[model samples]
Target chain A: GAGVSQSPSNKVTEKGKDVELRCDPISGHTALYWYRQSLGQGLEFLIYFQGNSAPDKSGLPSDRFSAERTGGSVSTLTIQRTQQEDSAVYLCASSILTGEGAFFGQGTRLTVV
Target chain B: AQSVAQPEDQVNVAEGNPLTVKCTYSVSGNPYLFWYVQYPNRGLQFLLKYITGDNLVKGSYGFEAEFNKSQTSFHLKKPSALVSDSALYFCAVSKGPGYSSASKIIFGSGTRLSIRP
Candidate 1:
C-alpha cells in the first residue's frame, strides 16, 4: 500500500459487544503504533510494536483492550465488552524505524452506543 | 520516561501573520522531536523532526521547529499563516536515534491552531 490503511472507516457497535479494528501498514515498515482519540481529546497511546513483538504495552487503558501485529505488517486492535466511553477514533501508524516520523492511517471511528 | 506537553489548548492567528505552537518535552536520553498536523476529518500528517543536528528543522508546508536542548522545547513556527494551515497540531518526542528499541514516541495534548481570515 502507498500509505497506512485501516478497515471499516466507521463502526457502530452496541454496548458490551466486541469490536475488532484492523491496520495494514506500508510495506517494509518495522514499527507500528496504536492510539485512541476521543471527541475533543488528545491521542491516547495504546501500544507500540517493533516488528511482530510489542515491547511497549504500558499505554493500554485496561485488560479489555489488546492488540497484536503479525508478520510485522498488518495489526489488529480488539476491544472487548465495549462501553460508551470506548467510542473514539482508533488510529494506527507505521514508521520505517523506531525514531522516524510515522505515517498514520485514516483511522477507524468506533462508536459504541 | 518520555513525555510531551502542549500548554495551550488553542491558538488564534490572523491569516498571513506569523504563528507559533508551543511544545516541551522530557526524556531520559537524547530526544527526537516531531511536529504533526491533523486537518479536519483526516489523519495526522508528519511535518518535521529533530533527530541529530541543526536545531532549526524545516518540513512540509513551510513549517519549521527549533530544538532547544536546554529548555527541552521544540516549538513549531511559520512565517505566514494560511487559512488552510488551521488545524490540530501535535508535538511528539522519542528517546534516541533511529532504530533504537526504546524510542517509543509520546505525543502531547494537541494544540488547535485557528487562522482567521
Candidate 2:
C-alpha cells in the first residue's frame, strides 16, 4: 500500500455490541502500533507489535479491548460489549523500526450509541 | 513515567507571522521528542523529531522545533504561518531505550493552531 490503510472509516454501533477495526500498514514495515483518540484529546497508546516478537498490550484500557496482528501484517482491534466511553477514533501506525517516525492511518471513527 | 503537556488549547496567529505551539515533557532519561499535525477528519502527519544532535530540528512543510533539555520543552515553531498550517498539533515524548520499552510514546493533550487571515 502507498500508506497505512484502515477499514470502516466510520462505525456506529450500539452499546454492548462488538466492533472490529482493521489496519493494513505500509508494506515491509516492521513495527506497528495502535492508538485511540477521543474528541479534543491526545493520542492514547493502545498496543504495539514488532516483527515476530511478543506484542506490547500494556496500553489496552480494559479486558473488553483486545487486538491481534496476523503474520506481522494486517491487524484487527476488537472491542467486546462496547460502551459509550469507547466512542472515539481508533488509529493505527507503522514505523520502519522502533524509535523511528511512524506513519498513521486515516483512522476508524467508532461511535458507540 | 513519560508524559507530555500542551498547555494551550488553541493558538491564533495571523498569516505570515511566526507561530509557536508550546510543549513540555517529563521523562526518566534522555527524551525522544516528536511533533505531529492533524487536519480535520484526517490522520496525523509527522512534523519533526528531536532524537539527538542539534537542538534545532527541521522537518517537512517548512516547520521546525527546538529541543531544550533544561526547560524540558520541545516547542514547534515556524517563521511564517500559512493558512494551510491551521490544524491540530500534538507533542509526544518517549523515554530513550534504556529507560523504558520502545513502544510507549506518551502524547500531550494537543493544541489547535488557527491561522487568521
Kindly report which residue pairs in candidate 1 clash with one another: none
Estimate, for each residue in A15-87, the C-alpha lDDT of model 1 and write its tens digit. Answer: 9999999999999989889999998678889999987454599999999999988777799999999999999
What docking grade does candidate 1 earn?
medium
lDDT of each residue in A1-101, candidate 2, tens digit only: 99999999999999999999999999999888999999968899999888888898989999999999999899999999999999999999998855677
lDDT of each: 0.91, 0.91
What fraction of the reference interface contacts is present in each model, in order? 0.66, 0.64
TM-score for all models, in order of appearance: 0.97, 0.94
lDDT tens digits by residue: candidate 1, B54-114: 9899999999999999999999999999999989999998877643465567999999999
- Residue pairs whose backbone atoms clash in candidate 2: none
Candidate 2, B1-117: lDDT as tens digits? 778999999999999999999999998889888999999977899999888889999998999999999999999999999999999999988776465455567789899999999
**Candidate 2: which stretches are off by over 4 Å?**
B97-101
